[model samples]
Target: MSGGYDLNLFASPPDCNFLCSVCHGVLKRPVRLPCSHIFCKKCILRWLARQKTCPCCRKEVKRKKMVHVNKLRRTIGRLEVKCKNAEAGCSVTCPLAHRRGHQDSCPFELMACPHEGCTARVLRGALAEHRQHCPHGAQERCPLGCGATLGPVERARHNCYRELREAWSWRQERSRTLVLGLLRRMREVHRTANLVRRQLAQLGGFLEEEDAMLVGAPQGEAEATPEGSMGAEM
Candidate 1:
């Protein structure tokens, strides 16, 4: 983390007391030592890591002896500061506490270019201008879903008509394959129907034979009854 706010960012010079002795910048998250000397929390902690003496008075300091000065921190927060991107054309001036918020949306902030294959870092405000002349920024893709990505150098040479023709040919081949599949399915269905018809014709012949036997059975029984009565009478 930054030890303190940049001294140059302040609208006016801060009082000497508000400066960290270790970092020589405005106190940030100020912490008072046992000797009553204050410095930025980060600066003091770092100084104590190397030597156990206060940066201001050379008094013996310990990590546990540090006391946070919330009032001083709040005071520093209220100081007016220019945007960090001021040199990049940002003119925003706000309280130290609000600097992060302003910087988040500052157009002059540096950002990596969004286009792939370009490693240039550019100010957000100048990205569009950069893209206009970037060798790899502007891109065009084949409209026929050919999966071809064209950069600025290849854009003029791109052949959309050829892509369209290839796409149409692929669709025609796919349609022919689908039609053949359907025709095969229809042939199978016709064969199944013919087999069903043949089975029904065989079943009809069996039913006709059964019906003829049923019709002749009653006449044969009647003729036997008359002969049996005449024999009984004799």
Candidate 2:
């Protein structure tokens, strides 16, 4: 009778699963129900909210059966340490359960634009758009004394000064060529005047020579003819 009707025969200990089905982390704040199944309180609560089932055996457990155990809370409390982002200069230390909340407001979590010359710093969510139109990003400047800042859209305008400078230099060169041509023409005129003066002097010399020759011949012929005629007439 003692072996067949023992009152303690129907009692069995609850099964404690050491692993969380979702995160695979150690079960802290273990929760248990009348079905003799155990799980972490936080993990089971989240799982129950999605579907009321035993995380270990997948047994249909009611959401009301989920209970928070103080022992597991104490265990998780001790595991809380400095945030993982502490290496990135975050000085806050919080529980793993609250780490996500702490990271949202973490000052050291700021991200700077990766684009060149962009000094803008923003949250992780806004980094994409900030990089798109980064005002301080890579830009060019006018090299031909335009003295203005330029972006990709202004590159053509920025180089306009080069063409303008070239045009001005061409005009200056044309003016210089014109002045040189006029000077060359004046030199030619001066040379022509000098040649004409020399020719005029030569012509005057020839004329004087002809006049003397004519006068001398006329005088000699007159003298010779007069003597002959006088003899013939007598």
> Quick one: best lDDT, which candidate?
1
**89, model 1: CA deviation in Å?**
3.5
- TM-scores, all candidates, are 0.59, 0.31
Worst window of 10 by summed lDDT in candidate 2: 1-10
lDDT of 1 by residue, 37-153 (tens): 988888888878899898767889888878999998888899899999888777889999899998888898998876668899988888878877877766856555667887776
Error of 2 at 88 (Å): 38
lDDT of 2 at 38: 62
For candidate 1, which ten residues in a row score worst on lDDT? 137-146
lDDT of all predictions, in order shown?
0.86, 0.65
Clashing pairs in model 1?
none
RMSD of each: 9.9, 21.0
Off by over 4 Å in 2: 1-158, 227-234
Candidate 2 structure lDDT: 0.65
